[model samples]
Target: MKRYGHGLVLGKFYPPHAGHHHLVRTAADRCERLTVLVCAASVESLSLEDRVAWMREVHPGVRVVGTVDDIPVDVNDPAVWDAHMAVFRAAVPGRVDAVFTSEAYGEELGRRFGAESVCVDPGRSVFPVSGTAVRKDPVGCWDFLEPPVRAALARRVVVLGAESTGTTTMAWALAEHYRRRGGVWARTRYVPEYGREFSEHKLTALRTLHPGASWEEVTFASKEFPLIARRQAQLEEEAARAGSPVVFCDTDAFATTIWHERYMGGLYPAAHEPRRQHLWLLTDHTGVGFEDDGLRDGEHLRPWMTGRFREELARTGRRTVELTGPHERRLATAVAAVDALIGEGWDLADPLPETP
Candidate 1:
């Protein structure tokens, strides 16, 4: 158990998983200070900044840095090795005491660095996973991924429409449907509309002042929509991190924008764009009747709201599935759409090849 003054742990870390963390931790434990160099190629799907950020968040105590290394890897080629070493050395100029790695190239890497090459779990016995396997099939390696990585990879599907159009019901049903698949799908999560919760709280506060304050009496300020949108985004992010490969939302920030327009009679300036939403399930109000659950008051405006949603969704170019018909039929259609989404695996580009 010889401790070193400075240690180095470098890798692509396309999406930092348990194995990468284990390697970093092991190196950190055996060294006074560790520098984790994350080398990403230009052709790769994941950005160097994101990979660096993920590593930094996961290994805060360790110094994490990133560099763009577009040079192809040919371990046996001295010229190619020299090119890579240049990139690695420039990124970690002060490193020297030890080089820690789990790959078979540890010996050569250590020799080039003029430091001891300590291999941690070279056989993949501990935390058996790799970036290659993860890129090919992220769902299969879901458990190995960290929260940040999972959040980034999760396919967020938003179920939204006019009030009482079964958006909440559909979201819940979809989550349960995925949970039935077992394994990682058992942890599938459904995010509730934060706007509804906000509305409920607002009504409660109003009633405290006026003993008989009704739902209609509870009004929304233009400023409140931004807050609601931010909270909705936060809740969706949290659910995506903890849940399965896909997360269902009963109404996301995008829907909040529409609600803001419906109530405030103008577009919200700070409406959050649904950047992470992979698909939208727009529940049509044709077959579903509006139920006044004390929080809803737009029964007559259902048609207008539904039409607006359709127009906005189309305008935004969002991938959407309009759910119509009976509850059972809608659920079945929703399930098929979700299954197809999941089937379209994460299209993470392959990294630079390393010669055997």
Candidate 2:
């Protein structure tokens, strides 16, 4: 028994907090057809794509659309309303029987289409959260944000260098450092080296399935490098989505690209295509000794590998910080760099680079 034939929920959804979700969901419940308009401006940090994605993810049944316009948020000005209504009509199309909002403008906006107004929590009593508050202190308002929004807001730091340059050690230390900050920054997460996971899986397959597989046999299997890159990418993205504000990745696809050159004889295009956003903490091979995990190429190969990392970093023009010295000193340097990057407004346009 729907009250309205069609419903429309429009918002800036700057970060798309829980309050916006409630309003949208409630409207969808009361209407047979619901459409959410995620209106954003160029000045906002969160992209229109992210806003639409979050809404659709959280409310799968409802139609979501994103539009970028510089229309001032002044409903008192009829000119502003006219411009907004134009954009709304373009985005939605067809007819709207109800306009849902938590603001007084709901009635006036609805009147544009001769639709009924559905206002909920105009006083903010139901969901005591606002977009402005969330923007000012996302960590403070973590509970108000959906997982996708939180994930979008989460900062990712990648540690990369030759094998055993204290990448894993520094990654965990960084996560612990943020975790100790506590409250909103409390649940820091560190992604382990996925190359190791790939190697282990291959070794298992060789033992059981192949029985007597050679290194060349496994390396030339055609699926090996791509699978590793894809799996590593998948793990990094999942960790980024659910991890704390500062998600520390032991190594990323860029590092995998470097490894692919060494182990797989050539670079795979997909491995090198990760969009450059992470503050790359390149672990210096100066003082740190390389430890041979059974999968390691060789101790001597590290300096060469480290050179390759430098080459790739230079080639990609990544935002990088070199970590050197003892474990504590290296961690301190990495932390400082990360803090500086954060201050400079480091964030993602989207959660991931275009990965195949």
Candidate 3:
């Protein structure tokens, strides 16, 4: 088997760390020569010249080249990128055999063209990131990203709901409460759960009828669906492990499941008697303001549906905690509940005794 990459393995070796170092060392061992391409030179943000300088300092004899002035910097204007690459490759008479990359599509693109692409994975499973524990705070993206990309996610939280229901107002109040209590708040990004995006799509899209399909067919399809149904326990576990003292999840996963069935006509069991355990019913939405998200069937549907959300929760055989009262009262109630749980030493580790 005559493998072409006994020669150069190429990549944009940006700020080479343990991962990059691992990839380059592995590639260098397998191949006779390696061409680390410093692409996106003219595009700014850590110039190609600087990258080459860093690589030269570290890699010593390893060959690296800059394509700053050579290639079309405007990749967003995709029409010119391919043409630009061709001219750039032609212009750089300096040799290269393959494009060395870790990204999946990058490998495919290289294979399609004349060049070969190498997948130099860092074996992420073994050496979990040093930055991971920091990410649990739900604050800075520093925990989620490498240094360069970490700076991109500067954020602020906005809350929304009905006027007296205290959406934006509660947001500020909570921020203050968290600050005074010496608590690190997971800034809440809440909006009315009217689910506008889903609503708009439903207007034209044919609604899957309730009377039409058998339970088995719908249940089977939902089970086989690619996106895994995220369990509530998993979320709780993450919040705890992240060491976040108080997690303010907007409507929880149970709420999500109920809403899916209620609004979008999502899957629900035909027989309600054999109920799932460890669920909460939406009860006492007496003061809850009902707002229309354009595609809402009408105002009348709100009251009927509000009651049903709770009934369905009870049907699941899950314990119900009905959130009630005015804006200040409800917000205070929620805070009180979290404080009470923390006081009682609510161990999130305990699995919901039964599934809802």
- Model number with the top lDDT: 1
Write down the TM-score of every candidate. Answer: 0.98, 0.89, 0.35
lDDT of 3 by residue, 43-92 (tens): 34445665676666556657766664434334344555476556446534
Checking candidate 1 for backbone clashes, the offending pairs are none
Clash number for every model? 0, 0, 2
* TM-score top scorer: 1
Error in Å for residue 99 of model 1: 0.3
Say which prediction, candidate 1 or candidate 2, comes out ahead on TM-score: 1
* Better lDDT candidate (1, 3): 1
lDDT per residue (tens digit) for residues 1-356 in model 1? 89999999999998789999999999999999999999999999989998999998888999999999999988889999899999999988975899999988899999999999999999889998999899999999999999899999999999999999999999999999999999999999999999989999999999999989899998889999989999999999999989999999999888888898899999886836558899999999997877999998999989999999999999989999999999999999999999999899999999988787
Error of 2 at 322 (Å): 1.1
- Displacement of residue 355 (Cα, Å) in model 3 is 39
Instruction: Give the runs in model 3 whose Cα sits over 4 Å from its true position.
Output: 1-180, 183-243, 264-266, 269-283, 293-295, 317-319, 346-356
Collision pairs in model 2: none
Error of 2 at 43 (Å): 3.9
Query: Model 1, which residues run further than 4 Å from truth?
Result: none
Q: Report the lDDT of model 3 for residue 45.
A: 41
Residue 291's C-alpha lDDT in candidate 3? 53
